[model samples]
Target: MIPFSLLDYVALFWYITFWLCFSWVVDHSRLKHHNLSHLMNGHRLRWMRNMSTRDLRMVDTAIISGLQNGTAFFASTSLLAIGGGFAMLNSTERAIQLFSDLSIPVETTRALWEVKVLFLILIYVYAFFKFGWAYRLFNYSSILIGALPYAKTADEQELEIAIRQAAEFNSLAGKHFNLGLRSFFFSLALFGWFVHPGLLIVTTTFVGLVLIRRQYFSRSQTLSMHLLPEKE
Candidate 1:
């Protein structure tokens, strides 16, 4: 096993720290202005309200099915990525030689390379679990949607309560799906680690900036805000 240098350890620690900090800021921070997530949440509430007014909610069911199918696709992709990582681990020597032949200057030993591959596998495994759970939550949300009382038969209060429950479940499933996608984004950054720690830092910063921009300042966020009330 090749021993990691102090810098290598620092790079790994920095990577983890930044990931955790970014996730917390995105999910928990209350900024002065609304982000995409906040706007989407407003839309979710509006969707449920609309659902309560309609006698038929086939469209809503279709949307929920789309979400479930998307989550399942991502989960399957994550599993495939894990399998690819394992395949890489099996051909560690060939991989190392290929890097050497490419004049890529990979300074790590075979053991370190294997460990990095394992780390990648771990990331995908975590993503798979997140996506899998998100898919299940979407299924639950669909069930809740089906359980909602019909507009023609139920009182206003009962309809409101049911809609609210279904909306909350859908929102939660969306949250987990976003988390899984975030992991996939970070995995792209992690690719730089195989080349150099400095490259990893640069790529991580780039990914973080891209995510923040899309979350808070993208055109999609603007459109979502337009869907909300002026007071919001």
Candidate 2:
């Protein structure tokens, strides 16, 4: 095992800490008024409200089905990625030789390479769990939608309660799905660590900046805000 240098340890620590802080800031911080997530949350609520008024709920069900399908797809992809990671671990000798031939100056022993591959596997495992749970939450949201009283029979208050319940579950599912996607993005950045600690720090910082921009300043956020109804 090639023992990790102090710099390697520091790089790994910073990568994990930054990821956690970034996720918390994006999901919990309300400093921004019209970030991508906030805008989508508003739309989720509006969608529930619109469904409450409709007699035919096929559209709402179809949307929920779509969400479930997307989550399932990602979960399956994560599983495949995990299997590939194991396959790479079994061929570490060839991988190390390939990196050497490519002139990548990474100082990796067999044990260290295995550890790196294991780290990658753990990341995909985390994503798979997140995606799987999100799929289940979407299913629960669908059931909630179905349980909602028919438009003709439901009182306004009853409809409001059902809509709120369904919307909350839908929002929670979306949050988990987003987290899974974020893991996928960060995994790409993690590949830099296999090259060098310095490169890892640089890639991590770059990825963080890109994610922050997409969340708060992207054109999609602008378009979503534009679609919102104006206040009186």
Candidate 3:
């Protein structure tokens, strides 16, 4: 395997590139509605033709949410893996201490380290599944948006149906991604704690700030209401 320093640089590079690409996809998707419409035919074309204003709003929110969750998962996991590797290298004594705390035998403790490696692998796997599912949900939302039934009467019933479907889809996608991001962040902190409690405290503080700012103060999210009106 590559050295921890090299791995950190690779992770940082991937995180930046993924963030930029996600942003571009969101912006392009919003601006290229006509192209998207043309690209999709038959059922998809008909659906878009029928979609209500509420459905459009929901679709927009879903796309933005998928991007947010996806970015968070990528960035957090990369940081965790790289940071964990460095921590293990610089703090072997501490790693042993942390891994051997259980009331298990010496043989068991050796096995436990192996298990910890597997645990970390599982965490990444879970994160990837969650992020992948979120992406699929957003894709489904886009398909639903395209398949909206545009009725001339524009009854309250139809609007309600569209809004509810869109809202639920977005919610499902958001929840999965949020869970994944949480897991990634917490696991990183756990690794840091083993390296040094002080480092764990710093990571925790930074993670908390990022979470708060993203939810309530980020430029895109904070002003989302004005940019894209709610369905209700």
Candidate 4:
């Protein structure tokens, strides 16, 4: 029989997983049936009929690339947090002590365990909100991409203006998604901090490495450049 303490950790782990999965479903559902022209330009097919094939293809690729890579990154981080939390639960008291020593109030010491639980709850909530918002912003970015004019347009001036608009809009949406992912690290660092300061630092470093690897080495992120330009 599993111990009740272990069960508690299991429950918390599942709770976090539930939210992450829920966000994934929501994200994928939004991505699956996208209407490129209407979404990008907020105009019907008639309005976008003037765009060149090359311009239309660029818009379609951007939407598909962003969703695929964003989903993979979200899944990876959620899994890491779940695994790390489980490991920390094995030494609950020590973890609590480490957290309390850092900055948590003494009056809350008796209720440290509860505080930790609350912190976990907050982390999950924050993560979901950020991820969900990013998904929406990416969707908006796709629409903006479609709104850009094709290179063959007679009006070179109009094409330049459209390109700038698309770039700015895509950049805005990309920032939100990237910032959302960074916010996850804040909670990750805190949870691990209470477990062991050294481990906390190590985990933090690993988190950075994982992000770098995903952005640079992961095939999914490589593909995402089709939607949002790769960062320097």
Lowest lDDT block of 10, candidate 4: 32-41
What TM-scores do the predictions have?
0.94, 0.93, 0.48, 0.47
| Per-residue accuracy of model 3 over 1-232 as CA lDDT, tens digit each | 3223443344434433543443344224453222221122222323333446343456654655666566556746655765565554555456577656756432223333444455555666667677767667766666655555555556778755764575566556655666566557645644443333345455555665565455445664534434333222
TM-score of candidate 2 relative to the true fold: 0.93
Q: After superposition, how far is residue 146 of candidate 2 from its true place, in Å?
A: 1.2
Which lDDT values do the candidates have, in the order given? 0.86, 0.88, 0.51, 0.51
Angstrom error of the Cα, residue 97, model 1: value is 0.6
Q: Which ranges of candidate 3 are over 4 A from the true structure?
A: 1-116, 151-155, 225-232
* Model 4: pairs clashing at backbone N, Cα or C within 3 Å: 39-143, 40-143, 62-227
Per-candidate clashes come to 0, 0, 8, 3
Q: Give residue 94's lDDT in candidate 4 (0 to 100).
A: 78
Model 4, range 109-196, lDDT digits (tens) per residue? 3344545645665565566566666666666656765666666753878765665565555544544555566557545645553343
Over the full model, what C-alpha lDDT does candidate 3 score relative to the true structure? 0.51
For candidate 2, write residues 157-214 as lDDT tens digits.
9888898898899989999999999999999999998888888898899999999999
What are the clashing pairs of model 1?
none
> Candidate 2 or 3, higher lDDT?
2
